[model samples]
Target: MGRGYLTKEMKILVTGGAGFIGSSFVRCFMEKRQNPVVTLDSLTYAGNMANLEAVLGLPRHTFVKGDICDPSAVDFAMKGVGAVVHFAAETHVDRSIDDSGIFLRTNVVGTGVLLDAARRHNVKKFVHVSTDEVYGAVLEGYSTEGGHLHPNSPYSASKAASDLLALSYHATYGLPVVVTRCSNNFGPYQFPEKLIPLFISNALEDKPLPVYGDGLYVRDWIYVDDHSRAVDRVLWDGRAGEVYNIGGTKDKANLEITDFILNKLGKPASLKKHVQDRPGHDRRYAMDSSKIEKELGWRAECNFEEALAQTIEWYRSNQGWWRTIKSGEYRNYYEKFFAGRLAGSSAGSVN
Candidate 1:
């Protein structure tokens, strides 16, 4: 929470700064670090300006509407920026299965464009926000930063491709690039389509809780704020051209998570409904974050249970915010974005 490491004059450009995790980073940088931040977001379905309302009038903050794949826009944003935090991507797994073209275009091609701009401008650092999904499913042990990438879905594959592209620039052009792959993050302002938020929203409305398959798949849950803090650490002291794994060290099965949500919402257990599991669903995922902890002295400080409760409370208090997002018009947006796509037909499959 201390601002000992960041300088007040540091200027940073954050792509995808209006989305869930990106928005959290923007808020943290503006309020906690007191650094000058310029945010670029394409205003996709998931990106909302309402998330940044708190810092809208701050002099040190600026927001631009642009695409990361456009060299001109990337170049314009990179000028005089000390660092680049790349978070722009097509991130939904189900949507990736439906249509991978956008995923490839934005996640892969967009990263290349940003890297080129950063290299040309000689930015001090380029931090790429990634996901543990790049490592695919973990049958047994946890995956470390050195683990081989075996991305299973179009979304993960796109991210893996971007990670490689960023590192390639670092290796070939000596660009200061660093990558951080984090576990599942849940917190306030998350879009309702994601698992945690979707379930929370439905449960609050007394709707059926959709459980894919038997709901045995497992994943590590990290509070969004804690993940944001880890990002700050990597930006400050993390080694260049290195990959760091950030995890909460808390693993929960999908069924357990569903039960927790039901209990938190005071919903009946009978609301749980079994549905057909998506094809090639990864069985489990875990992360070994010792590298970051030992090297950068970073660890997740938020308690998962408490954070989950707080998130539920946030949704309860902010019903109007999500109600507008769940209207019939939003359903039309979903259909247009993912029309004529099968659940399991994609170029990438989990290993």
Candidate 2:
């Protein structure tokens, strides 16, 4: 099988390009393909330009600071862009439990705005990057592209709504749109609030590692780079209006993942602390990416253990990067935004 090739003349718009996964997509597209990338990001607390510092100077890349909910912003950004990769959203579940208003507005309404723009502009394709959380907790079998949506959190519900909206546009107006629901992604340049980076940073500083509930929640992990590659493959070769599930096929319980982090950091397991679980926390999430594997021949090539080791090393050497964000300003923001929220509740510590 040969590598899939995209036409070099397409102008691509990548929303949320300053965040973790979005930044990875932008970098990969710019480095591997000969297409112009216009990054549309709102620069929310999670969307940091430092994540894209590596590709900022590239001539083929451009950045626009704007919200996805604004139709004018979407229209302005879509100009001359043949394809749109929608990645902007309020994604943290704990934060969503505090205030679902933002999530609903940004993830749902914002997605509608983009789809409307894509339809009006007749974009060649629109790729929506969604999550496995939309399927909620899956105890037995893996979630395929056609599984029922059972979103548990406000964040997941919002994403599920957006996924339907994206697909509806394809079905109704004949727009060329595809969706990718992927498993938990961890890698370099990820924000510290996410589980993997949070654990890595806290463990390195000897801070108590916070694990929600009993720390038995299971998640399938995929490296951010691999997820980005899957998205690229889907954009080029996928069938319009289809959904593709991308996962590492490596399921690890939260406790086991924490233990792996501790071992990788050469730290003792004493730092583990279990806190009260957030409301409506899903127990397990797994994805069957066989559809993508069979159609596009894309599979996660990186080993989970190796990726975990590399991620820990990244944080170890990049303390200055995360330290700046862990200061009074960030803490004050958390206090103001989510002080009495579900995630802030006091609970028993895990062994």
lDDT of each: 0.86, 0.86
lDDT of 2 by residue, 1-351 (tens): 112224678888899998999999988878898888888887788977678888776778877767888887788788888888889999898899999999999999999999999888778888999999999999998998888999999999999999999999989987888999999999998889999999999998999999999999999999999999999998888788899999999999999999999998889888999998889989999989999999999999999999999999999999877886776254454334333432321211000
TM of each candidate vs. truth: 0.91, 0.91
**lDDT value for model 2:** 0.86
Q: After TM-score superposition, what is the CA distance of residue 328 in candidate 2 from its true location, in Å? A: 6.0
Tell me the tens digit of each residue's lDDT in model 1 across 133-235.
9999998999988889999998999999999999998899888899999999999999998999898999999999889999999999999989999998888
Error of 1 at 167 (Å): 0.5
- For lDDT, the strongest prediction is 2
